[model samples]
Target: MKWQRFFLLGSVGLVSICILLSTVRNLVSINTNCPLSRVDKTTLQPTWPKNRVTSSNLSLNRDNKVHVIIFTRWKYGSTFTGEILNNNPDFTYFFEPIRREVYKNRKIHRGVFYQDLIPMLHNTLKCEFIDKNYTWWDEENKSLDCRYSKKLQNSILCEKSTIEKRDISAYLSKESRSRMVEEICRSVQHVAIKTVRVPDLKHLKSIVTDDSLNVKVIQLVRDPRGVYLSRKVTSDVCDMELSECDELKNNLNYWKDPPFWLKGRYMLLRYEDLADDPIEMVHIIYDFLGLPVPETVKSWLRINILKMSSSSKSAYSWRTKITYKTMVTVQRYCMDLLLMAGYKPVNSEKDLTNLKIPSIRKFSYPLMPNITFGVAKPNTV
Candidate 1:
């Protein structure tokens, strides 16, 4: 009887542990309130390469491909998109430490904190920053609106109280920006750098005292309707929202402006296109970035299904409530943005069924469909 009771207790203990473990897993997977807790990276950390394949023992040579900069907005698959690119063994991913710090601290004087970084932007691959974080209030056009009022409470700012004192956009000169980006691509490496921010590109252009930055741009667009809808639900706008973004031009014409990074080389990726045929869309981007394609990327390509979940939520987000009032407030501002972006104002869920734009990735053949483009470009370097 003693032995049987011990065995029974052991079985119960094991079952209890299993149940506890299962609950913990659910909390990690389903909980969005805590983002970091849910971000499980399966990639093992490895020491970054310091040299080119045929160059010095530690420094990479000039055979590297284009340094990919992720100009992304919030809630538009930027995270997952970065993940897909990084997981490709040939590509390396670097997050923007300066931007991350700004995000957490709410403000950064580029004069002090970013001085060390400006010089380091050259001859590197895979550098990225969140574009939404690059903006500040633009008072000239009376465009400093209420989208980011929540952050004002904690930000530390004053003309003299800060570190960098130059005009915010003047510091990052266009010539310097272009040179750094060009050098990064020319380096004999296949690393990717992504920066997501809605800096006053127009303002940035004006203040860019130097006009010679080789900053080829890849302007990404999402449906203004969807963008506004997402902003409404989250009560937050990404860097590209016209109201919050100073000097942002609408339509393809934005690319032709003096400050605009010009070229077929200066590409445009639509968010809807990316979601629809991510692999093919990415291939076009890969080609544009001057990088070779990856096998894993070929496997992950799909468009229609990729967007179903977000589309469903966009359709019925009103019925759902993380905080109903908060969502409503966000919606009001979003409506204003929609009108500004030339999107039809949508309140009722019934109207959403008509939007037909696909993500860039969706435009490509489904599931990395066999395409002639995969014929790797000859060593362009």
Candidate 2:
């Protein structure tokens, strides 16, 4: 009986050894030559993909279950926007690319492997972006054949705002522009940029041309009154003709097809209506992106102003409530691009009057060339 017991103990010891070896193999660091490789297999990679400027882009295809890109504007309810989607372990929330410090190191999640991205995966999340100078689209494609060519085309994109006329040549560049394109296509399963302007359409098209990819563009249109009011309160703008709404319209219309990017791919969200019913707005947004409703999103239902002292669910409301000092600088930084994108300036009471928008504004739509602002904001009335 003693000998038999000894044999059984030996067998159990061997099995345990095998299990440990298998786990070590599975958890081995493969993608990055991170320092953790020598220390431990479980240590997180402190430096993200772009930290070292590694050009390795993750493959994005039908294999990816859910990837959402929020191409919106400031004060578009992105906090609640994040709350609506941030709960999902399958979805990732990238609030603002410019001020990425919602986490650590005060750096944006510049680049990452899609496979590594799972749901409920944000480290630190909030919205306090101070540099509107960060509005970088596709600056690498300098050839006029696409967008950055022709002085007239450049004029439309880099136009000075009537409020604060300034030259755009300083901020516009090729490197940052190129990076933006690669980040979108190569990301694991989500790319969201608040304050998407007109020239950015060119960048959108060049990067997202694949027919198989399910990319959705989300545009948040506040009452031109509110937008202008926000712009005025903050004194944010480039050198643009305040009354020249038609020039902005023409520029917006120009980019509608193969040459134009992200036209049919985007969905418009009104700021006021979103403030009224946050959950319903996000619910529809999830449907448009074809993502299952995340349970965490339920926490952000009725937030009017963004608050740093608030809960994580209010992430989408960052624009409504950010540092007062950052409010104007950020707005001024994005002013030129916003103006170029036909961001309507608030005029008469009729302009900022619509908040309860039309039904179609809630769902997804085809990327049409001449998109009419058809939604009726009844609640604002």
State the C-alpha lDDT per candidate: 0.40, 0.38
TM-score of 1: 0.44
lDDT of 2: 0.38
Q: Estimate each model's TM-score.
A: 0.44, 0.39
- Residue runs of model 2 more than 4 Å from their true location after superposition: 1-61, 79-83, 98-199, 232-264, 302-381
Off by over 4 Å in 1: 1-64, 108-188, 202-216, 228-242, 245-253, 258-261, 302-381
- What lDDT tens digits, residue by residue, belong to model 2 across residues 247-316? 3333344332323344334555555445544444554566455454544344333222233224222322
Number of the top-ranking candidate, with TM-score as the measure: 1
Q: What are the per-residue Cα lDDT tens digits for candidate 1 across 154-176?
A: 22211122465533323444444
